[model samples]
Target: MSARLEVRLDDERKQRLEQLGEAEGVPISEVVRRLIDDAWEEVMRARRIAAVERMAQLEVEDPPDPETLSRELEETYGPGGLS
Candidate 1:
């Protein structure tokens, strides 16, 4: 569900938005919603990218090698290890 929003813009901005909406064959509100949604999507994408990069950094700081892990497990438990 969505609620109605009433915003007051300067005359020049309102006219420009109206003109753009007309050229795009859509309502001014739709044009504004599209612009806002696009900006929000970009922000979210950047945040996700930053989170992935942070996770990569953390992984590099505490890395686990498969070969060393296998050898340690075999030495501790048995030849077949946990399997």
Candidate 2:
């Protein structure tokens, strides 16, 4: 399915979009869509990084034994899996 979006861009931004589209041999709409997708990916990547940092900073009570974790890793994935 296809959808339509109507957007109003300032003259400068509209010109830039037109220039970019011309340089890429595509329509301004395509350029805008690509820019939107790129921006979305950047935002998602930042969120993922923040989540990982938060998880790293978390303190877990009653943490598992190192030996037990190693054994489990080895059993699940064979030798060198502990790394």
Candidate 3:
């Protein structure tokens, strides 16, 4: 099943949609559908980005200190430290 949306655009925007539809030889509804699809995709992409940023923040909240890691690396390898 599919849902429906009803939007009201200003005169200039409506005219632009109409012009684009005519130029592409498609109906205004198709233009609206494509625009809505693009908008929804952008919204979801932004949400995903926010989620990833939050996860990274949580993961790095108490990350390993740099000096300790360097010491461990030096112990594993000799003075050159794997070049």
Q: Give the top-scoring candidate (lDDT).
A: 2
Across residues 38-78, which tens digit of lDDT does each residue of candidate 3 receive?
99999999999999999887845565699877887789996
Model 1 regions lying over 4 Å from their true place: 59-68
Error of 3 at 65 (Å): 18
Best prediction by TM-score: 1
TM-score of each: 0.74, 0.71, 0.59
Colliding residue pairs in candidate 2: none
Candidate 2 residue-wise lDDT at 9 = 88
Better of 1 and 3 by lDDT: 1
Which regions in candidate 3 have their CA more than 4 angstroms from the true location? 1-7, 60-83
Q: Pairs clashing in candidate 3? A: none
Candidate 2 wrongly placed segments (more than 4 Å): 61-83
Q: What is candidate 2's lDDT per residue for 14-51, written digit by digit as tens?
A: 99999999999999989988999999999999999999
Cα error, residue 48 of model 3, in Å, equals 0.3
lDDT of each: 0.92, 0.93, 0.89
Task: Point out the higher-scoring one by TM-score: 1 or 2.
Answer: 1
Candidate 2 differs from the real structure by a C-alpha RMSD in angstroms, to one decimal, of 7.7
Please provide, for model 1 over 1-83, each residue's C-alpha lDDT reduced to its tens digit, 9 standing for 90 to 100: 88899999999999999999999999999999999999999999999999999988774555469898888899999899987
